[model samples]
Target: MNIRKMADSGNDFLAETDSPLGLGESGKPIPSSPRVLSILSSVFERSIQKNEKLLKKLKTKDNVTVFHGSRAPTMGIGQYIDRISKYTCCGTPCLVVAYIYIERYLQKMDAYLTSLNVHRLLITSIMVAAKFNDAGCHNNTFFARVGGVSTKEMNRMEIEFLSNLDFRLHVTADIFRAHCLQLQKEGFGENPINHRPSNKTRAKCLPQIAGYTCRAV
Candidate 1:
């Protein structure tokens, strides 16, 4: 399937069937990390290629340089995400939160997500999201090894990432739902989620999803 095209087609009925899991709907389980990671990875790959072309012409670094590795890591971004999920078991909410943070930082910095910097940025953002959202999370050293970075660099990256975002990590329920909506829009194409969530008829979240850090397990 064309991963990039998933975001383009307006009626992705098949993808939508299971894609909207973990939106705190009754009987639906937490979203699958592999499925969400596939979508996120496709977006990252497209962004890197698009930014690569743009940077070649512009030839300027700006804040992007801070995240750039000494050289690009050999592992594919999808595989790297898989490895992190496999070992850390931080789950889909953390991955989605990391996505939100990455976009937030990019907007703040106007930085391009290039191949040289994407992996490092992802590792840092995911680590921060894990700490913020997960009950028991790994330390910087464990995350560093998962991302193929050193403990020292991981420490530096975490501080730098937090500093760049001004350490604002509290994602509210509405904001989280909006992000989930956007993720669904990408997977099922951009009609924009029209169904207003009702406190009216839905069952209470199995583990309480609103106004908290999305621990719906």
Candidate 2:
């Protein structure tokens, strides 16, 4: 998106989230208003689900089998992201970085996101993002419980995910903002990618994670 240039165009701008605690392992404080995490989660989740279904459709004639080893979670993607945010104490920027990692993973794996892999992918990406972007973070064992996977499995997935992305963990601030704007555009109200929690609903549900701020681009 050449997000750096877009930032210069003045369609949108970045403002640091209120950081009473100051920046530390979590990078800047999460902005206190934008629903970027929820939007991105919805968008990414729907894209993966749709593409997985499409691939299966094409394979039906050939009798090519697809295995869905894990079931989809009861919590929606937005809610799931909220849980990750709260449990990991990752800044909102981590959500943006995690989205970037997921895109890279899909491109590299030549695979669609699916019920079997999405939760694992989401958790691993966020954990990796936090380690790379946040100054400090919890260990894999902690994230394992948060993500409903064993610590060993979470560790394995983290390695595999990093290798998939060629260990490129740096994401510029402009790119991070660009991802947020993209999610807002793509996954905002009634766009049909998936249902998104409204700002009001999210506010009540995610008091801590709701601090991220954004304006229209």
Q: Write the per-residue lDDT of candidate 2 for residues 30-125, one digit (tens) a residue.
A: 432234554666686788778778978888321111212335556666766767766666654556667788888778767777655666678888
Per-residue lDDT for 89 in model 2? 65
Taken over the whole model, the C-alpha lDDT of each candidate is: 0.63, 0.58
TM-score of every candidate: 0.71, 0.68
lDDT of 1 at 155: 87
- Against the true structure, candidate 2 reaches a TM-score of 0.68
For model 1, where is the 10-residue window of minimal lDDT? 208-217
Candidate 1 runs further than 4 Å off: 1-31, 62-64, 189-217
Worst 10-residue lDDT window, candidate 2: 208-217
Cα displacement (angstroms), candidate 2, residue 173, comes to 3.9
